[model samples]
Target: MKINRLLNNNVVVVKEGEEEIIVMGSGIAFGKRKNDIISPDKIEKVFVMKDKVEYEKFTQIIDQLPEEHIALAEEIITYAEKVLKTKLHEHVHVALTDHVSFAIERKKQGFQLKNKLLNEIRVLYSAEYEIGLWALQFINDKLEVQLPEDEAGHIALHLHTAKLNTYTMDETVSTTVLVNELIQKIESKLGVKVEEDSISYQRLMTHLNFALRRVSEGKPFDDVDHDMNELVKEKHKSAYNTAVELGHYLLESYEYVLPPSELVYLTLHIQRIQRNNGEEV
Candidate 1:
């Protein structure tokens, strides 16, 4: 291998058999200046590019990344690929690699670091970790090697977030809990029997879904009247207000806040259902 461009004393750009590779570690290019004989033992990783354009792109990427970060990223990619038996997409690999690198740096600086995206990461990539660990054990019995546990934990968190984002709670169970509470407060004001399973209730659920989607997309509520139903306009307005209020309440009481649009949609749904069967709202 010959040096092409040196990123740092610890990191170096090199050519190996007509392939460009980013070598990392303490002694990657040790003792030898540029164009000097490189030691294979000191080299940690060799990132082979597909072509000259990719080589240039990879070089630029390495320049932006810190040395320690590059090392951790390489470690993560190698471990994931070798042990997990799963091929992560480039996008996911890059994201995970960068996150791991930054995390390690933060920890070394005495910063109490927590992977905020840990849950999401776990949900998305736990299978990879499971396979990786199994492979590691198979490679060397009593090797005592371990996969990145913290990183694995984060993957699990993402799964939880995904579930909450996609699934709607049953009206008779979780949804009813919130709906019943709201109905009790508005019963005297509207003066009607609230039915839990009415068609209006379903409509309200649909409305809530719309509002939630808008909120999740970061759209403003003022833009909400685009193609709404005329008959449900007043009901939706009322529901939106209540949903916002309930969202705030949940945030304050349980430190859990749904996005504004989500709350708007959910509240509208509950209100519409409660006012079903000729009930007043």
Candidate 2:
């Protein structure tokens, strides 16, 4: 490969065939002047060009970005992959670079746009967002391309969703705990003690499972009752009210919004327990 532009001693922009690639490492581009041949061993990542715009944009950015920024970008990308378990897709990289360039320009113009989203971004993405920011700096400094805000928002949302998976798992665990507690409360209040291993408890578990399933499927509570188990009607009114109350409590306490279908199941369980204990409808 031929050196296209030198970002620093350890990093260089290289042209392979018709595409430009950024090569990085401790001594990858060391002592190599422009137009010099680069050893294959020194090459790290070869960013193949997907189109003319990408090539032009990348080349332009490489020309202006400082060496330290380039190194930082590389470090960020590496850290994000290892820590966040996410790969910054190529489109995201391009978008981020553009944003970084704009941020710097805005700063130079005395317009301070505090990227408070950076904190949420870092927390959600672990460290991948940091790498994205570094890449943005490189793009801004080298290519002078300003990234769009919408693109950055989309990238951040994607990272946030990945982080949300953990929360979802926690929600599942909490749902189980809440269901158990509610059952205990009902048994204690009604004086009709049902064994934990009784058929009724098993059936209640089934209803709870269905509720969780509905939530996952995004079904609405009003629409969730069709084709439901007939046994659900035995305590329909109480179940419905209990489900609604529980749903509201969860939303208020943990910001968890249950889908309609799950609400129906929870309501069914609540009603069944209340009716079995001779509670008035």
Candidate 3:
């Protein structure tokens, strides 16, 4: 392929047929310039860019990061997709690589940040958490530094964000905190403990997660049934009131306004949890 530009001595942008892509290999562009032909055997990794903006972002990351960091992050992402059986958003390439690079630097400087949502993430997103554990081991094996398991939860959040394409890393963390707070509110208002291992608890967590996603994206539940909503409120007054309070809590705390349909569903889930705990709904 003919070189379009060089990101660094180890990374080059090249053209193949109708597509422009980034290629990385050690010393592949050591003595090369624009329009130079790259040997096929010298290419180690090929990243396909979606547009000019993404191309530029990828180039900037390639220029600034150590080759090993980029390669390790890409390797973890690849393994995650294989195990999870899905294609993640392309933004993961830049986000995860940058995160890994910074994380490595912080560890080298003897700095560490604990992931507070580690338990919630491990329970709520078990699949991604498992992959995170794998990534920690992989990093330890490849880099020879034992990164804390809390980092596994952080990595899992990144994979989950990429899978959903909903929020950035920071937003994801905030959302997780909100969900946990909502659960606590439910327990306090309805006077019921939600056992994490129970199916009822799992359903409640899943529903709240997607409910928040819908609200944040400004997409409310469609085809709302007025009769059912009224029936749910009338039959389960305590649970319905708890849902209403939670809605106000979201609005006041996070500026999230829950729709009427969302409120109905939330009340039903709350009633189910209360009933599962042998408490009056």
TM-score of each: 0.39, 0.41, 0.79
Give one digit per residue, the lDDT tens place, for model 1 in 1-281: 77777866677877777666667667676566778766878876655445566456555656677665555455556665555454433333344445544545555565654544332233333465464344334322422333345545543322222232332223212322443354455444445555434455335433534444444455666423424533344556665555566666655764554754455456556565545644345
Q: Which rank order by TM-score, best down to worst?
A: 3, 2, 1
In candidate 3, clashing pairs total: 0
Q: Global lDDT of each model?
A: 0.50, 0.55, 0.84
How well does candidate 2 match the true structure in TM-score terms? 0.41
lDDT of 2 by residue, 114-185 (tens): 443433333333344554555455555665655443334333443333342233424434555555555665
Give the higher-lDDT candidate: 1 or 3: 3
Regions of model 1 farther than 4 Å from truth: 16-18, 51-58, 86-94, 104-124, 129-281
- Per-candidate RMSD, Å: 12.3, 12.8, 3.4
**In order, how many clashes per candidate?**
17, 12, 0
Candidate 2 lDDT score at position 11: 63
Candidate closer to the true structure by lDDT (higher is better), 2 or 3 = 3
